[model samples]
Target: MKMPFFTSFILLVLITQIAIRRTSYKIESKEADFWEKERKANFTRKKPLDNLNYIKIPLDSLPFGKLDDDESRYCEKVIRSLADQKVVNLTGFTNTDLKLEYGAPNITELTKYDQNYTTLVTNLQKWGKLLYDAELYNEATTVLEFATDTGTDVTATYKLLTDLYQNKLTLSDSEKKEKISALLPVAEELRSLSKDQIKRLLTESL
Candidate 1:
Protein backbone atom coordinates (compact mmCIF):
# COMPACT_ATOMS: atom_id res chain seq x y z
CA MET A 1 0.00 0.00 0.00
CA LYS A 2 1.22 3.47 -0.89
CA MET A 3 1.44 6.05 1.95
CA PRO A 4 -0.15 9.49 1.50
CA PHE A 5 2.23 12.41 0.79
CA PHE A 6 1.51 14.26 4.13
CA THR A 7 2.07 11.09 6.14
CA SER A 8 5.45 10.46 4.48
CA PHE A 9 6.45 14.11 5.06
CA ILE A 10 5.60 13.89 8.75
CA LEU A 11 7.58 10.68 9.16
CA LEU A 12 10.66 12.24 7.54
CA VAL A 13 10.37 15.29 9.81
CA LEU A 14 10.23 13.16 12.96
CA ILE A 15 13.27 11.15 11.91
CA THR A 16 15.25 14.32 11.25
CA GLN A 17 14.30 15.74 14.65
CA ILE A 18 15.44 12.61 16.43
CA ALA A 19 18.76 12.63 14.62
CA ILE A 20 19.33 16.29 15.54
CA ARG A 21 18.57 15.66 19.19
CA ARG A 22 20.93 12.70 19.33
CA THR A 23 23.74 14.65 17.74
CA SER A 24 23.26 17.56 20.09
CA TYR A 25 23.27 15.29 23.11
CA LYS A 26 26.49 13.64 21.97
CA ILE A 27 28.23 16.99 21.54
CA GLU A 28 27.09 18.20 24.98
CA SER A 29 28.19 14.96 26.60
CA LYS A 30 31.66 15.19 25.05
CA GLU A 31 32.08 18.74 26.26
CA ALA A 32 31.03 17.75 29.76
CA ASP A 33 33.50 14.87 29.82
CA PHE A 34 36.34 17.09 28.71
CA TRP A 35 35.59 19.63 31.39
CA GLU A 36 35.39 16.90 34.01
CA LYS A 37 38.82 15.63 33.05
CA GLU A 38 40.26 19.09 33.35
CA ARG A 39 38.69 19.62 36.75
CA LYS A 40 39.98 16.30 38.10
CA ALA A 41 43.52 16.95 36.91
CA ASN A 42 43.75 19.88 39.29
CA PHE A 43 43.60 17.61 42.33
CA THR A 44 46.30 15.26 41.11
CA ARG A 45 49.13 17.61 42.07
CA LYS A 46 50.31 18.85 45.42
CA LYS A 47 48.85 22.13 46.58
CA PRO A 48 50.41 25.61 46.38
CA LEU A 49 53.96 24.91 47.58
CA ASP A 50 54.80 22.65 44.65
CA ASN A 51 55.90 25.10 41.96
CA LEU A 52 56.30 28.29 43.93
CA ASN A 53 59.35 30.41 44.70
CA TYR A 54 58.75 30.53 48.42
CA ILE A 55 61.24 30.12 51.23
CA LYS A 56 59.71 28.42 54.24
CA ILE A 57 59.58 31.01 56.98
CA PRO A 58 61.35 29.68 60.06
CA LEU A 59 59.39 29.20 63.31
CA ASP A 60 62.33 30.47 65.39
CA SER A 61 60.47 32.47 68.03
CA LEU A 62 58.57 34.41 65.38
CA PRO A 63 55.32 35.38 67.07
CA PHE A 64 53.41 35.27 63.78
CA GLY A 65 52.96 32.31 61.40
CA LYS A 66 54.60 29.75 63.60
CA LEU A 67 55.25 26.78 61.30
CA ASP A 68 54.70 24.12 63.95
CA ASP A 69 51.11 25.15 64.35
CA ASP A 70 48.45 24.74 61.65
CA GLU A 71 50.10 25.89 58.44
CA SER A 72 46.73 26.48 56.82
CA ARG A 73 45.66 28.75 59.65
CA TYR A 74 48.77 30.81 59.24
CA CYS A 75 48.12 31.07 55.50
CA GLU A 76 44.50 31.96 56.09
CA LYS A 77 45.47 34.94 58.21
CA VAL A 78 47.89 36.16 55.54
CA ILE A 79 45.26 35.81 52.82
CA ARG A 80 42.63 37.70 54.78
CA SER A 81 44.99 40.59 55.28
CA LEU A 82 45.37 40.76 51.50
CA ALA A 83 41.69 40.84 50.68
CA ASP A 84 40.58 43.62 48.33
CA GLN A 85 44.24 44.27 47.67
CA LYS A 86 46.24 43.95 44.49
CA VAL A 87 49.83 42.63 44.20
CA VAL A 88 51.90 43.28 47.30
CA ASN A 89 54.23 46.20 46.85
CA LEU A 90 57.80 44.97 47.28
CA THR A 91 58.76 48.46 48.41
CA GLY A 92 57.18 47.66 51.75
CA PHE A 93 60.09 45.34 52.48
CA THR A 94 63.78 46.13 52.43
CA ASN A 95 65.18 44.93 49.10
CA THR A 96 67.26 41.94 50.18
CA ASP A 97 66.53 39.03 47.85
CA LEU A 98 70.07 39.56 46.58
CA LYS A 99 71.83 39.41 49.94
CA LEU A 100 69.71 36.56 51.31
CA GLU A 101 70.72 34.26 48.43
CA TYR A 102 74.07 33.35 50.01
CA GLY A 103 73.12 32.34 53.56
CA ALA A 104 69.55 31.32 54.38
CA PRO A 105 67.79 32.74 57.40
CA ASN A 106 68.63 29.51 59.27
CA ILE A 107 72.13 30.89 59.82
CA THR A 108 71.95 34.55 58.81
CA GLU A 109 69.78 37.16 60.49
CA LEU A 110 67.53 37.40 57.40
CA THR A 111 64.63 35.65 59.19
CA LYS A 112 62.99 39.01 59.80
CA TYR A 113 62.54 39.59 56.04
CA ASP A 114 62.10 36.11 54.59
CA GLN A 115 58.92 36.33 52.53
CA ASN A 116 56.34 33.52 52.62
CA TYR A 117 55.14 33.75 49.03
CA THR A 118 53.57 30.31 49.12
CA THR A 119 51.20 31.02 51.97
CA LEU A 120 48.92 33.30 50.01
CA VAL A 121 48.79 30.92 47.08
CA THR A 122 48.01 28.02 49.36
CA ASN A 123 45.21 29.88 51.07
CA LEU A 124 43.76 31.05 47.77
CA GLN A 125 43.65 27.48 46.50
CA LYS A 126 41.87 26.35 49.64
CA TRP A 127 39.32 29.14 49.49
CA GLY A 128 38.72 28.69 45.78
CA LYS A 129 38.17 24.98 46.22
CA LEU A 130 35.80 25.61 49.09
CA LEU A 131 33.78 28.12 47.11
CA TYR A 132 33.62 25.84 44.11
CA ASP A 133 32.49 22.88 46.21
CA ALA A 134 29.78 25.12 47.67
CA GLU A 135 28.67 26.00 44.09
CA LEU A 136 29.81 29.56 44.49
CA TYR A 137 31.73 29.86 41.24
CA ASN A 138 31.48 33.64 41.18
CA GLU A 139 32.91 33.94 44.64
CA ALA A 140 35.63 31.50 43.76
CA THR A 141 36.49 33.51 40.70
CA THR A 142 36.72 36.69 42.75
CA VAL A 143 39.03 35.07 45.26
CA LEU A 144 41.22 33.56 42.60
CA GLU A 145 41.43 36.82 40.71
CA PHE A 146 42.80 38.50 43.80
CA ALA A 147 45.32 35.70 44.20
CA THR A 148 46.57 36.20 40.66
CA ASP A 149 47.67 39.71 41.54
CA THR A 150 49.42 38.59 44.68
CA GLY A 151 51.90 36.52 42.66
CA THR A 152 52.41 34.08 39.81
CA ASP A 153 52.86 31.17 42.19
CA VAL A 154 49.09 30.75 42.18
CA THR A 155 49.13 28.31 39.27
CA ALA A 156 46.75 25.89 40.97
CA THR A 157 44.31 28.55 41.97
CA TYR A 158 44.39 30.08 38.52
CA LYS A 159 43.90 26.71 36.86
CA LEU A 160 40.88 25.74 38.92
CA LEU A 161 39.36 29.18 38.75
CA THR A 162 39.63 29.25 34.96
CA ASP A 163 37.91 25.89 34.81
CA LEU A 164 35.05 27.17 36.95
CA TYR A 165 34.72 30.25 34.80
CA GLN A 166 34.71 28.20 31.62
CA ASN A 167 32.39 25.40 32.69
CA LYS A 168 30.24 26.75 35.50
CA LEU A 169 29.92 30.37 34.57
CA THR A 170 27.67 31.59 31.77
CA LEU A 171 29.91 33.24 29.25
CA SER A 172 29.86 33.64 25.52
CA ASP A 173 32.53 31.97 23.46
CA SER A 174 33.99 35.26 22.31
CA GLU A 175 34.10 36.63 25.83
CA LYS A 176 35.77 33.50 27.10
CA LYS A 177 38.31 33.66 24.32
CA GLU A 178 39.10 37.25 25.13
CA LYS A 179 39.60 36.47 28.80
CA ILE A 180 41.85 33.50 28.09
CA SER A 181 43.98 35.51 25.72
CA ALA A 182 44.41 38.28 28.24
CA LEU A 183 45.26 35.85 31.04
CA LEU A 184 47.73 33.65 29.17
CA PRO A 185 50.33 36.40 28.87
CA VAL A 186 50.14 37.20 32.55
CA ALA A 187 50.69 33.58 33.43
CA GLU A 188 53.57 33.32 31.05
CA GLU A 189 55.13 36.48 32.37
CA LEU A 190 54.88 35.23 35.91
CA ARG A 191 56.36 31.90 34.99
CA SER A 192 59.33 33.57 33.32
CA LEU A 193 60.18 35.88 36.18
CA SER A 194 62.65 35.07 38.93
CA LYS A 195 61.48 35.63 42.49
CA ASP A 196 63.23 38.96 42.58
CA GLN A 197 61.84 39.95 39.18
CA ILE A 198 58.35 39.04 40.22
CA LYS A 199 58.71 41.16 43.33
CA ARG A 200 59.93 44.04 41.24
CA LEU A 201 57.09 43.80 38.71
CA LEU A 202 54.47 43.43 41.42
CA THR A 203 55.75 46.40 43.36
CA GLU A 204 55.99 48.55 40.24
CA SER A 205 52.43 47.66 39.27
CA LEU A 206 51.31 49.32 42.45
Candidate 2:
Protein backbone atom coordinates (compact mmCIF):
# COMPACT_ATOMS: atom_id res chain seq x y z
CA MET A 1 0.00 0.00 0.00
CA LYS A 2 1.44 3.41 -1.00
CA MET A 3 1.57 6.03 1.71
CA PRO A 4 -0.13 9.41 1.11
CA PHE A 5 2.13 12.14 -0.37
CA PHE A 6 1.59 14.42 2.68
CA THR A 7 2.46 11.56 5.04
CA SER A 8 5.67 10.82 3.10
CA PHE A 9 6.67 14.48 3.13
CA ILE A 10 6.09 14.67 6.89
CA LEU A 11 8.26 11.59 7.42
CA LEU A 12 11.06 13.08 5.29
CA VAL A 13 10.94 16.30 7.26
CA LEU A 14 11.19 14.41 10.54
CA ILE A 15 14.17 12.44 9.29
CA THR A 16 15.91 15.60 8.08
CA GLN A 17 15.29 17.27 11.43
CA ILE A 18 16.76 14.32 13.27
CA ALA A 19 19.87 14.35 11.06
CA ILE A 20 20.37 18.09 11.58
CA ARG A 21 20.04 17.74 15.35
CA ARG A 22 22.58 14.90 15.41
CA THR A 23 25.10 16.89 13.35
CA SER A 24 24.68 19.92 15.53
CA TYR A 25 25.19 17.81 18.64
CA LYS A 26 28.41 16.35 17.27
CA ILE A 27 29.78 19.77 16.35
CA GLU A 28 28.97 21.19 19.77
CA SER A 29 30.54 18.21 21.51
CA LYS A 30 33.74 18.54 19.45
CA GLU A 31 34.02 22.24 20.17
CA ALA A 32 33.48 21.64 23.86
CA ASP A 33 36.16 18.92 23.95
CA PHE A 34 38.67 21.15 22.17
CA TRP A 35 38.19 23.96 24.68
CA GLU A 36 38.52 21.56 27.59
CA LYS A 37 41.82 20.29 26.25
CA GLU A 38 43.02 23.82 25.65
CA ARG A 39 42.10 24.77 29.20
CA LYS A 40 44.06 21.84 30.56
CA ALA A 41 47.02 22.75 28.31
CA ASN A 42 47.13 26.20 29.88
CA PHE A 43 48.03 24.58 33.20
CA THR A 44 50.60 22.19 31.84
CA ARG A 45 53.87 21.96 33.77
CA LYS A 46 57.12 23.49 32.58
CA LYS A 47 59.47 21.44 30.44
CA PRO A 48 63.03 21.80 29.15
CA LEU A 49 63.44 23.57 25.83
CA ASP A 50 66.96 22.33 25.14
CA ASN A 51 65.75 19.98 22.42
CA LEU A 52 64.45 22.87 20.36
CA ASN A 53 66.76 23.93 17.55
CA TYR A 54 67.79 27.60 17.46
CA ILE A 55 69.10 29.67 14.57
CA LYS A 56 72.47 31.41 14.96
CA ILE A 57 73.24 33.99 12.31
CA PRO A 58 76.76 33.91 10.85
CA LEU A 59 77.78 37.56 10.54
CA ASP A 60 81.39 37.07 9.50
CA SER A 61 80.48 35.41 6.17
CA LEU A 62 77.92 37.79 4.64
CA PRO A 63 80.11 40.77 3.87
CA PHE A 64 78.42 41.49 0.53
CA GLY A 65 75.11 42.80 1.90
CA LYS A 66 76.03 46.51 2.08
CA LEU A 67 77.66 49.05 -0.20
CA ASP A 68 78.05 52.88 -0.23
CA ASP A 69 74.35 53.48 0.41
CA ASP A 70 72.14 54.35 3.40
CA GLU A 71 69.58 51.62 2.65
CA SER A 72 72.22 48.91 2.54
CA ARG A 73 73.83 50.23 5.74
CA TYR A 74 70.50 50.15 7.58
CA CYS A 75 69.86 46.66 6.27
CA GLU A 76 73.28 45.54 7.51
CA LYS A 77 72.56 47.01 10.94
CA VAL A 78 69.33 45.00 11.20
CA ILE A 79 71.10 41.83 10.06
CA ARG A 80 73.98 42.34 12.49
CA SER A 81 71.61 42.90 15.43
CA LEU A 82 69.95 39.52 14.79
CA ALA A 83 73.26 37.66 15.11
CA ASP A 84 72.99 37.61 18.93
CA GLN A 85 69.21 37.31 19.22
CA LYS A 86 67.47 34.11 20.23
CA VAL A 87 66.09 33.12 16.84
CA VAL A 88 64.17 30.01 15.85
CA ASN A 89 61.82 29.06 13.02
CA LEU A 90 58.81 27.49 14.67
CA THR A 91 56.86 27.65 11.43
CA GLY A 92 54.74 24.49 11.47
CA PHE A 93 54.38 24.20 15.24
CA THR A 94 51.13 25.22 16.89
CA ASN A 95 50.30 26.66 20.30
CA THR A 96 49.30 23.19 21.48
CA ASP A 97 52.67 21.81 20.43
CA LEU A 98 54.49 24.58 22.23
CA LYS A 99 52.56 24.04 25.42
CA LEU A 100 53.13 20.31 25.26
CA GLU A 101 56.87 20.60 24.66
CA TYR A 102 57.98 23.73 26.47
CA GLY A 103 54.98 24.13 28.80
CA ALA A 104 52.38 26.88 28.78
CA PRO A 105 54.48 29.29 30.79
CA ASN A 106 57.33 29.16 28.30
CA ILE A 107 55.07 29.77 25.33
CA THR A 108 55.66 33.52 25.47
CA GLU A 109 59.43 33.16 25.39
CA LEU A 110 59.29 30.59 22.58
CA THR A 111 57.00 32.83 20.57
CA LYS A 112 59.41 35.74 21.02
CA TYR A 113 62.30 33.58 19.83
CA ASP A 114 60.36 32.64 16.73
CA GLN A 115 59.59 36.31 16.22
CA ASN A 116 63.31 37.02 16.18
CA TYR A 117 63.75 34.61 13.28
CA THR A 118 60.79 36.28 11.61
CA THR A 119 62.56 39.62 11.91
CA LEU A 120 65.76 38.06 10.60
CA VAL A 121 64.16 36.53 7.50
CA THR A 122 62.22 39.73 6.77
CA ASN A 123 65.41 41.79 6.97
CA LEU A 124 67.24 39.21 4.86
CA GLN A 125 64.73 39.66 2.03
CA LYS A 126 64.87 43.43 2.34
CA TRP A 127 68.68 43.42 2.43
CA GLY A 128 68.86 41.16 -0.60
CA LYS A 129 66.49 43.43 -2.52
CA LEU A 130 68.49 46.48 -1.49
CA LEU A 131 71.62 44.89 -2.88
CA TYR A 132 69.87 43.89 -6.08
CA ASP A 133 68.36 47.34 -6.46
CA ALA A 134 71.85 48.79 -6.05
CA GLU A 135 72.98 46.75 -9.10
CA LEU A 136 75.15 44.58 -6.89
CA TYR A 137 74.22 41.26 -8.47
CA ASN A 138 76.91 39.15 -6.82
CA GLU A 139 76.22 40.68 -3.40
CA ALA A 140 72.48 40.14 -3.77
CA THR A 141 73.06 36.54 -4.72
CA THR A 142 75.14 35.98 -1.58
CA VAL A 143 72.50 37.45 0.76
CA LEU A 144 69.49 35.80 -0.96
CA GLU A 145 71.20 32.41 -1.08
CA PHE A 146 71.89 32.64 2.66
CA ALA A 147 68.23 33.47 3.33
CA THR A 148 67.00 30.60 1.12
CA ASP A 149 69.37 28.06 2.68
CA THR A 150 68.26 29.07 6.18
CA GLY A 151 64.80 27.57 5.45
CA THR A 152 63.12 30.96 5.58
CA ASP A 153 59.34 30.80 5.21
CA VAL A 154 59.40 34.37 3.93
CA THR A 155 58.21 34.06 0.32
CA ALA A 156 59.94 37.29 -0.66
CA THR A 157 63.32 35.70 0.02
CA TYR A 158 62.44 32.90 -2.37
CA LYS A 159 61.13 35.38 -4.95
CA LEU A 160 64.31 37.45 -4.81
CA LEU A 161 66.42 34.31 -5.10
CA THR A 162 64.34 33.14 -8.06
CA ASP A 163 64.84 36.53 -9.70
CA LEU A 164 68.58 36.34 -9.10
CA TYR A 165 68.87 32.85 -10.56
CA GLN A 166 66.56 33.32 -13.55
CA ASN A 167 67.71 36.79 -14.61
CA LYS A 168 70.43 38.52 -12.65
CA LEU A 169 73.07 35.88 -12.03
CA THR A 170 75.75 35.03 -14.64
CA LEU A 171 74.93 31.31 -14.51
CA SER A 172 74.18 29.46 -17.78
CA ASP A 173 70.68 28.32 -18.71
CA SER A 174 71.26 24.80 -17.37
CA GLU A 175 72.87 26.11 -14.20
CA LYS A 176 70.02 28.51 -13.69
CA LYS A 177 67.47 25.75 -14.18
CA GLU A 178 69.27 23.52 -11.71
CA LYS A 179 69.35 26.26 -9.06
CA ILE A 180 65.67 27.00 -9.64
CA SER A 181 64.85 23.30 -9.40
CA ALA A 182 66.59 23.14 -6.02
CA LEU A 183 64.10 25.68 -4.66
CA LEU A 184 61.08 23.44 -5.41
CA PRO A 185 61.47 21.37 -2.24
CA VAL A 186 62.19 24.48 -0.24
CA ALA A 187 58.98 26.02 -1.50
CA GLU A 188 57.01 22.85 -0.79
CA GLU A 189 58.35 22.76 2.76
CA LEU A 190 57.39 26.35 3.59
CA ARG A 191 54.84 26.89 6.37
CA SER A 192 53.98 30.38 5.13
CA LEU A 193 50.54 31.12 3.70
CA SER A 194 52.23 32.71 0.65
CA LYS A 195 53.88 29.42 -0.37
CA ASP A 196 51.63 29.00 -3.42
CA GLN A 197 52.65 32.43 -4.63
CA ILE A 198 56.33 31.47 -4.24
CA LYS A 199 55.75 28.22 -6.16
CA ARG A 200 54.02 30.12 -8.95
CA LEU A 201 56.81 32.70 -8.96
CA LEU A 202 59.39 29.92 -9.38
CA THR A 203 57.53 28.18 -12.23
CA GLU A 204 56.48 31.29 -14.19
CA SER A 205 59.71 33.20 -13.64
CA LEU A 206 61.71 30.48 -15.39
Most accurate candidate by TM-score: 2
Question: Over the stretch 1-206, how does candidate 2's per-residue lDDT look in tens digits?
Answer: 45698899999999999999999999999999888878877889998888777877778778643587777788789878888778888887888778877789999999998888888888888888888888888888888888877788777787778878878878999999899988888888888787888888888866
Report backbone clashes per prediction.
0, 0
Count steric clashes of candidate 1.
0
Model 2, residue 110: distance off in Å is 0.2
Who wins the lDDT comparison?
A: 2
TM-score of each: 0.44, 0.81
- Model 2 scores what on Cα lDDT? 0.82
Residue 66 in model 1: shift from native, Å?
A: 27
lDDT (C-alpha, whole model) for all candidates: 0.52, 0.82
RMSD of each candidate relative to the true structure? 18.4, 3.5
Residue pairs clashing in model 1 are none
Q: Tens digit of lDDT per residue, candidate 1, span 1-206? A: 46688899999999999999999999999999866654554334322222323333222322232222354455556765544333232222322332332222221222322233444556667766766776777766766766665544544665675676568889887766565555555555554335444344333322
